[model samples]
Structure formats: C-alpha cells, structure tokens
Target: MTPHYTESSLRQPRTPHIRMPPFTGKEGWETWRAQFEAIANRYGWDEEERLNQPRLEGAAAQFVFSQLSPMC
Candidate 1:
C-alpha cells in the first residue's frame, strides 16, 4: 500500500535567503550596473570621489581593508 500524503503536508514553505550577484554574462552586467550606482551612493564610492581622495597607506589602508573585508 502507498503512504498517504496531504497537499498541505507535501508543500513546505520556503525560507528566504540572501543571494550572490550573478556576475557573468549580459544579465549579470545589467544587474551589476543597476545595483552598482545605489551601492556606490550608499558608501560614497564613486569613481571621481575615489580618484580625488588621497591614496591611503599604513593604518589608513588597514582600516579601509577591514571595511572591505567579507563577513563570515
């Protein structure tokens, strides 16, 4: 005999999870371009701003490095 299964029991609710950027093809480039401006604005990381700023070294460099480090 086959085991019984209800529709509600068969369907599990999906939990939301963070996803990485699909950085490969045309779709990826479009996604990046769309998101990049917002991200850059949020972090004040525009190209001109970066170019105008003094090059950081020593402790300043370390601080910037730490800021850019990925969290586990």
Candidate 2:
C-alpha cells in the first residue's frame, strides 16, 4: 500500500514575503535599517543581543564590516 497526499499538502503554502526597498544614500541605509528592525521585532529579536556575544574576528566579521565599508 502507498501513502496518500492531499492536493493542498502537495502544494506549497502561501507565506508573507517581506522585502526591503532599494537604498540610494545615507537616508537609504536608515530606511533599510528601519525595515530590518521591524522584521526583527516581528520575530521577537533584539538587535542588541548579538552585542553580548564575542566580536566576530574572521569571515563572519566581514558581513558587517563590508556593509559599512567606504564607497569609491
């Protein structure tokens, strides 16, 4: 005997998709940060919590370092 699957089960469930708007300058970064903070808040995440952990010193640090890197 084979297990049965419902049409709904076979179909992917719909989920809310949140995307940040494009940034053009310092204002853009602030806008993006606001959206990020909102999403974090929705999931009960504290932006400051990560600060409690040891600072990243390798490839992991680049994630944030690159974001703040000066542009040409």
Candidate 3:
C-alpha cells in the first residue's frame, strides 16, 4: 500500500534571506573592516608556505588542512 502526501509534506518551508548586520556608519565600517583585515592577515598563508607541507592522507587530516587553507 502507498501512503498519501499531505499539504504540509508537499510544500517546502521558505528560508528568509538574512541581511548581515550593517555597519553603524563610515567610521564603524572602517573599524570593522580594519579588524577583519588584521584577522585575515594573521591567518593568511602564501603558496610557498603550503607547498612545503606534507600530504594529508585521511578525512580528519583533510578537515584540519581545510580549516588552515584560505579557501575556507
């Protein structure tokens, strides 16, 4: 026997598009942008830094590697 679908099951829920919190004003935006740049620069790596690394061989290693990679 086959089960029948209800209206609730037939429709997917809508997800609201959330806007990121706006910068309060120009000064606030500049401050935030500077902070972000500092953090990114602290973590960013050059290609040469990556090339010397050993190859990852497992899922866990790959996950950690991804977290360190800029692509994340």
Candidate 4:
C-alpha cells in the first residue's frame, strides 16, 4: 500500500514567512518593542525564539553591536 499525504501534512512550518519590521528608531523604542512582542506572539515563539532577536538596523543596531562587541 502507498502512504497518504494531506496538504497540511506536506506543509513546512510558517517560520520562513516571518518578516518583522526592522528597528530603525524612526518610531520610538517602546513602539518597536511592542511590535516585536506582538510578532513573537503571532508566531508563538517561546523565550528561546525571542532571544534569536528580530531585525535591528541603523544607529540603534550599531549602538547595540558596539556595546556587545566587547564580549564577543
């Protein structure tokens, strides 16, 4: 007998489609953080997934990278 495959059974996880708005600092940090959290919730990301970090761009990214670079 041959195996059966349904549409959903053949589907991959939805993680590939996640496209978060990068943190550009044009909006305030609070706003961006809220969006980030919302995205996490939408994707049902746990603490580990949250720690993976969303897209951080521009001056904010630069500052954070600089601060953390010492530990790298």
Candidate 5:
C-alpha cells in the first residue's frame, strides 16, 4: 500500500514575483541601494556587507540592476 503524503511535504515552495521599481536618474544606484538596504534590515539580512560591496561603476550599475531586478 502507498503511504499518504502530508500537505506540508507535498506543497511546493512559492516563487516571489519580482517587480522592477523605478530608478531615480544618475543618483538611482544610491537610491536603489538605500531602499534595498532598508528592506534587508527589516528582514534581518546582512545589510552592512551587501551595501559595502564594490559594485560596477556608473551606467554599469543601471544596466545590472535592470537585468537582475526582473529575475529577483
């Protein structure tokens, strides 16, 4: 006889729907990073290192954020 599966074990994890929020011009990276840091803090994430990481400079940040946000 087959064993019955419990609801918790049978359920699949939900995928989050990532939204691409608006970036604020040239200062957008700073703004985005600040907002992201705030959210990370709220969730008890490691905000310090994340914000301090060496990121791609200037327009590269914009390009990367746009590409990654949709997949988040």
Candidate 6:
C-alpha cells in the first residue's frame, strides 16, 4: 500500500548542520570570501542558503539586517 505524507514528517530541512564561523569583520574580506565560497561549493549551497548563511553575528549581523531585507 502507499503511504501518506504528514506535516510533521514533511518538515525536515534540506541543509546540513554544518555552520560557518560567524563573520565579525575582524578577518580580512579576501580570506573570508575564499573560505565562504569553498564551503558553499563543497556543500552545494543553493541561493537561499548562500544569502542567509554568511554566519554574521552580534553587531555585524544586526548591521547586515539593518542594511538589507531578510531573505529566509
């Protein structure tokens, strides 16, 4: 017999648990960009994750949010 899909069962995130280090603007942009691109390439991040997963935190994250609209 076939099975039915429930809301709870359908609620799994496709992204993995791996998290990039939070960007605090202390690191050089070139070095940070390289690492970010590398991880995204390795993990096959889609557009949404690419925009949202820069790992910005604290004031840096707030600054970004204030500067731009939320995507996720």
Q: Pick the candidate with the highest TM-score.
A: 4
Clashing pairs in 1: none
The Cα error of candidate 1 at residue 60, in Å, is 32
Better of 1 and 4 by lDDT: 4
Per-residue lDDT of candidate 3, residues 1-72 (tens digit) = 899999998653232232233333433546755664454345453454323322334554565556676653
How many backbone clashes does every candidate have? Answer: 0, 0, 0, 0, 0, 0
RMSD (CA, Å), candidate 2 to true, equals 11.0
lDDT by residue (1-72, candidate 2, tens digit) is 999999988754232344444333434455656776676557554445322222344444565568677553
Off by over 4 Å in 6: 1-15, 62-72
Q: Estimate each model's TM-score.
A: 0.30, 0.30, 0.26, 0.64, 0.32, 0.61
**lDDT tens string, model 4, 1-72?**
999999987765546677778887677999889988898888888786777667778887888887776654
Q: For residues 1-72, could you state the per-residue lDDT of candidate 1 as single tens digits? A: 999999997753232232334333334445555675555455555576433333345554566667787553
Model 4 RMSD in angstroms:
4.6
lDDT of 3: 0.46
User: Where does model 2 exceed 4 Å of error?
Assistant: 1-27, 47-72
Q: What lDDT is obtained when candidate 2 is compared to the true structure?
A: 0.50
Candidate 2 vs candidate 6, TM-score winner: 6
Query: Over 4 Å off in model 3, which ranges?
Result: 1-27, 45-72
Could you tell me how far off, in angstroms, the CA of residue 9 lies in candidate 4 after the best superposition? Answer: 11
lDDT of 2 at 65: 66
Q: lDDT (0-100) at residue 1 of candidate 6?
A: 88
- Candidate 3 residue pairs in clash (backbone atoms < 3 Å): none
- The true-versus-predicted C-alpha distance at residue 9 of model 3, in Å, is 36
Q: lDDT order of candidates, best first?
A: 6, 4, 5, 1, 2, 3
